[model samples]
Target: MALDRWIALVFVTFCCAYGYLAFATMDQLLPPFMQRNPVWPSTFPKVLAILGVIVGLVVLFGLEKPDSQSEPSATDINYRRLHEYKLGQALMLLGLMALYALSLRPMGFLLSTTVFLMAGSAILGERRWVIMFAVSAVAAGSVWYLVQQVLGIFLRPLPFFLGG
Candidate 1:
């Protein structure tokens, strides 16, 4: 009846549903090479579902006792400051996400994701320009490389003009 149990049960149910979706939607036809391979497009997602189910079951059954040390300390801010929710910042981030989604095809994954990361960080109050640019570019490039090159997925990394 505890909150953690509820969360774990929800997690397990979600994982089961996810795994079913992967199985039900799997492609029926593939090139001869790919058809014979053990790793399909859904392999990773199904593996994630399995892992999630295991972790959720462990959490659901492993708890011995609730710890009282989770109580907030003196340095913690009071939760009554709902007026400082920074609604403007949240709205800006949402707008930025919408722009990123719209720009993905034209700007390509690498450029759009890098810009999104930098803009999101700036909107969240990161002041160091060089660090923001470097981190965003590296993270975006790394993900693009992994998804496109390593996983054999197609992702346009450059703008349309650049032959993405």
Candidate 2:
């Protein structure tokens, strides 16, 4: 849909900004010794930003063009549903995301992400406590394992007291 193209464009903008920040700010923060390494701390964020830009570009231009003579088709989204937007929930989610970012290093990936996921789900109206906890734990732990162990990215998966 054309709306998707707009979203992709916005995504591309965000990626470009993030990449620029990684290049301009993050790289300079590393000490000379660490900067000399093949993979500096900024490397991952830059790579991710590049990948995001590529994906956004693909989404932006890969769609079929609508014929000029044809009427609007079912592919178009029903913007009328915009009335269902919940401002309070969105603001709460944004605040939660900010808190998660702040807590990531101090609390470690496993605990921070698990709590974030659980609280996010509850904010979005999930009521099953057991299921929510299980899903949150699995999702966060799996991501932590993949990023830290499999990818060798060195995330702190547990608290400092637990020797993460």
Candidate 3:
């Protein structure tokens, strides 16, 4: 009758249904060639469903004890002391990600990744711009080279103006 028990019951039901559907529709969802593989495409979903069922059973049975010391009291709740810097940094990082995604194809992987790393380091309070840029360049170039040359995975080419 407790909230945790109710949540667990719902979670178990959903996971069971999801697992059943995933297994039932595996053949239809996957290509014929893909179905030949030992690890089917539905494997991840089925695994997650099983894990979810286990977690739900644990929660429903109340296997874990609630820690009283970690619980916040009514008096301990203070809105004024909230850390703004952490929130601001998180928002900035998200914005940078969006910008990077938008510019990636046009700017190429190496250039976009370098800029993203430099911006992320600066936002995280790194002071030395020169060193940050150098590190960013090296890291980005290494990943690009490894993926393109060693792994044979081609990235988006640079724009025509930049000599793709």
Give stretches of model 3 more than 4 Å off. Answer: 1-26, 31-37, 52-85
- As a whole number from 0 to 100, the lDDT of residue 54 in candidate 2 is 95
Per residue, candidate 3 scores C-alpha lDDT tens digits across 58-159 of 988877645665654544424455573378998999999999999888899988999999999999999999999999999998998899999999886565
Clashing pairs in 1: none
Assess every candidate by TM-score: 0.54, 0.55, 0.67
Q: Rank the candidates by TM-score, best first.
A: 3, 2, 1
Highest TM-score model number: 3
Please report, as a residue range, the 10-residue window in candidate 2 with the lowest summed lDDT: 63-72
Candidate 2 lDDT tens digits, 56-125: 9987885455447365466555565555668789999999999999998889899999999999999999
Of the pair 1 and 3, which is ahead by lDDT? 1
Cα distance off (Å), candidate 3, residue 23: 4.2
**Residue-by-residue lDDT tens digits, candidate 1, 134-155:** 9999999999999999999998
lDDT of 3 at 91: 92
Candidates 2 and 3, the one with greater lDDT: 2
